[model samples]
Target: MNTKWWKEAVVYEIYPISFKDSNGDGIGDLRGIISKLDYLQNLGVDVIWMCPIYQSPGQDNGYDISDHYGIKPQFGTMHDFDELLKEAHARGLKIMMDLVLNHTSDQHPWFIESKSSKSSPKRDYYIWRDSKKGLSPNNWESYFGGSVWEPDEKTGQSYLHLYSKYQPDLNWQNEEMIHELYKMIRWWLKKGVDGFRFDAIAHIVKAKGLPDADNPKHLPVVQAYQFFSNLEHVHTLLRKLNEEVLMECDIMTVGETSGLGPEQALEYVGDERHELNMVFQFEHMTLDSPSTGTSRWESRSWTLLELKKIMSRWQTTLHNKGWNANYLGNHDQPRQVSRFGNDTEYRVESAKMLATFFLTLEGTPYIYQGEEIGMTNASFQQIGDYRDIETLNFFELAKTKQMPEDKTMAAIHAKSRDNARTPMQWDASEHAGFSDAEPWIKVNDNYKDINVEAAIQDPDSIYHYYRKLLALRKQHKVIVYGEYKLMLPLDPDLYVYTRTLAEECLLVILNFSHDTIEFEWPDQLAYEARELLIGNYEEVPEERKEGMLLRPYEARVYMF
Candidate 1:
């Protein structure tokens, strides 16, 4: 039995930059997170997976780390981080730092030295290839829409950077570099961090000899990423890291594995494999992208059937052999309520429904900050309001391609990572109470109505529903360990599933659409005497015996 505490744990992801600001510097600092420890404890999350807080050049919004050991001055001193860690542990909440092991900022000492001389001891620390006639080693495109190669001014050679040029990929073949990362991990473990979430880990192991992706220009960058992501050697390195560093402590590890499916995910998370605790797959996240190779920029209308199938496949495929890291939205994605649910009139109901679907499923649920308050997209009209490196790079690409302005802006509004990076709306005060001064980016315009203060005042807000749902999750062990079975999988509007564990059976019914529909249980699921656990609407004393009319985006959980 996988009786690990992490399996039953629910995590709250904190994008520190947008969480809160204590120094009134228009940016969230470590001290701000310390102030919110009680709020997070009351919210009922077991772990806090904070996004990158290391010293960075900010080219990729802190993902580009200039120093792994130092804390960013904008965030706070290392002393502040120690206080925050101490405060969180006192409240029984664990800290999980986001570690970017695949790469480091070009300003990093190692990278600086590596680029300084070809004969430098750390010259092999990064992937460098000789350019022929000013041409790159491969035609691979970075995730931020440019060639992965950046030429050195002194030498005609180029180095590889999978995301941004400022963030160069590390050569995993360097045993010394790997040991340095392991040493860094041990340093944090000694400092008492509970766990880690590896960023873009699958990209660490590149294809042998730095081969060019086949016809990269004809395919979406995501399609090209598959050629380098999840290679077999990645498993070897993960095994070494697990046996050498992570296994030394009781820590939870999750890897950001892009474009991997259920079978491939099992390779990383299978307990016997000793690689990682779980992995974050991107199959479901990419469903809305154009299938003909426009990448994630061009959004397409996706059906509920598609979502259910993708989610269920992951849930069932990894049921017993491996674990799952369940998450609907995170720092790199758009807001949950805006992306998946009706964020306008039925925002509360739909957000609750989506929460019901996410939390009740089999795995650790990671609730992004402000998701409880049902935050919507930032909807930044002009490119100037955007701050994410990926979005800005895409904007430049759109101009070079001469894409329509309205279309480009619309794509940015819907798909920009900035949509999730907006300042948290704590109240209706200036800058949504995130800071006393101007924020690094503009706050969402709807803060007057969607702020946390308003949500807390309303009993039926998404925040309260999430709190109630979390309480219910704690009360029932079945919700954590039950086997998931999708019912009426073909239904377009309703997502019905049953979680069974020993004598406990939980029936979860979610109405995804805005239209009300009476749903009767299919004959396959035998009727049993059950009590309503929780729902979006007010509780009714009368029991629902056979079937009931579900309101627009209504949700219900029943225990039999």
Candidate 2:
């Protein structure tokens, strides 16, 4: 298979609100990101996927966009954004904006106009319906909580919102609205954006004719997502968008798709299809929770088999048909070191092992900010310290349900979105050197040891390991475009795989358990291991008499 530029690219995701605060305003901005471009470049990332910066009420952070053409004043002006883009490209990095077309802020001009009168042309731009049987038009639930249909006091009708009521879902059935979105997209493309990270792209199409979902379980208000997820006509609309805009621009477009299986995911990004360059499927990410409700953080214990199954299925499924965006953590997710590994003890080793597992897979790797230094999740003791809207809503829900205060607090400690939203820690100084002013969120308590300054100066630091991993991917064709084969498939303590191209072959071995384990290679790989490219532990042993042995959490990559 021919390799595309994006196929081997390493993308770094930045949450603009928490990255840096250039002006001592406490909140991060475009100027802050510009100041950090050199940092990202030094970390060896090829692309940067920035979260939403559009004008918004911030009900759902910046996902509730009010305008597509302008940047939010809090983040800075369009001029600042343009400067950031220019600087990034000048440094040989590509930029991708977050495209939030699934919903718009309730304050958007279209929504304000749509909610005015029944005869208004803009009324059809949003999903509005008259009450049935003296109740909501449909039995659908918003993702945040309660009914998805919120009554408009002015029109005496309800409007749909799959998320917060402040974010109303758009009616893709409206041709005019689609055209307007296309024009906005083209406007951004003309500004020289390399691509887009499409937010909630799968929820674009709703059930045709507006039929009620046949949900037998869940509350009456919880069936809203069923009415739209992976709808039949959604692919047609996506193909149209791809042909009209994405394909012509020669840009990389990744979709945030929920409720899509490996097979359907392939259809969205297949070679012959003009839908998307890649899709971020939630199968692996959703393993800890059920589709109907949230999981209790303390009650969850993820097994090795489960993790392997989720990743293996997607890797094998998309290996030949399309591409994938490999990620273990992002702005929305808790730091991988805290959630996936024992951050208290084996922070460095386990972080390196996790990095190996992800970057060695056949996909485009994405590194969230602060991940290279092995940052753990923020520890907020009180609910008052949390700023995420979802966290606050869930805490209120817990209180109203009469749950124990301590238990609720513990749950928040484990699952709060604020864990990932804390300001970046640059050093061990006050506010972790993120800014001269107070940070928007509290820094992790262990910043003294885990901050960037400490890691960058140490040759054996996690930061250095990441640099080595990325350099290998950039320089070796076998690592970038090779076929992936799983080895030691049933070992509970070991995770291993091989990458092979025409003449080069590489073996990746990881010890996932806490205790050391020994492995006797099969006859095919029994020959003396020649080149020990990278290893989380110390140097490889000289002899292969007992095959190979690994210390707890040790990872190794070898070539013969």
Residue-level lDDT tens digits of model 1 in 1-560: 57898998999999999999999999998999998899899889999999999999888889999999999999999999999999999999999999999999999999999999899899999999998666777778888877888999786689999888899999999999999999999999999999999999999988887776777346433235755788999999999999988988898889999887898899999878999999988888987887785468989998999999999999999998899998889999988888889999998889999999999999889999999999999988889999888888888989999999899999999999999999989999989999999998999999999888898889888888889989988889899999999999999999999999998889999999999888886565566766778888875423355677888998888887
> How does each model score on lDDT?
0.90, 0.84
The lowest-lDDT stretch of 10 consecutive residues in candidate 2 is: 290-299
Best-performing candidate as measured by lDDT: 1
Against the true structure, candidate 2 reaches a TM-score of: 0.96
Give every collision pair in model 2. Answer: 140-221, 141-221
lDDT of 2 by residue, 1-560 (tens): 85799888899999998888888878889999999899889999999999999999888779999988879987899999999999999999999999988889999999999998998889999999888988888776666777788998988899988889999999998999999999999999999999999998889888876666666665565445667787778889999898787777878889988888788898888878778888887776666554445443433666677777778778788887888789988887778877777687788999999998899888899999888999888868878888888788878887798989888887777677778788888888888888889777777788888888999899999999999999999988888778888776677888888888887888888887888789776556646754778988766654466576688788888785
Worst 10 residues of 1 by lDDT: 216-225
The alpha-carbon lDDT assigned to residue 528 of candidate 2 equals 72
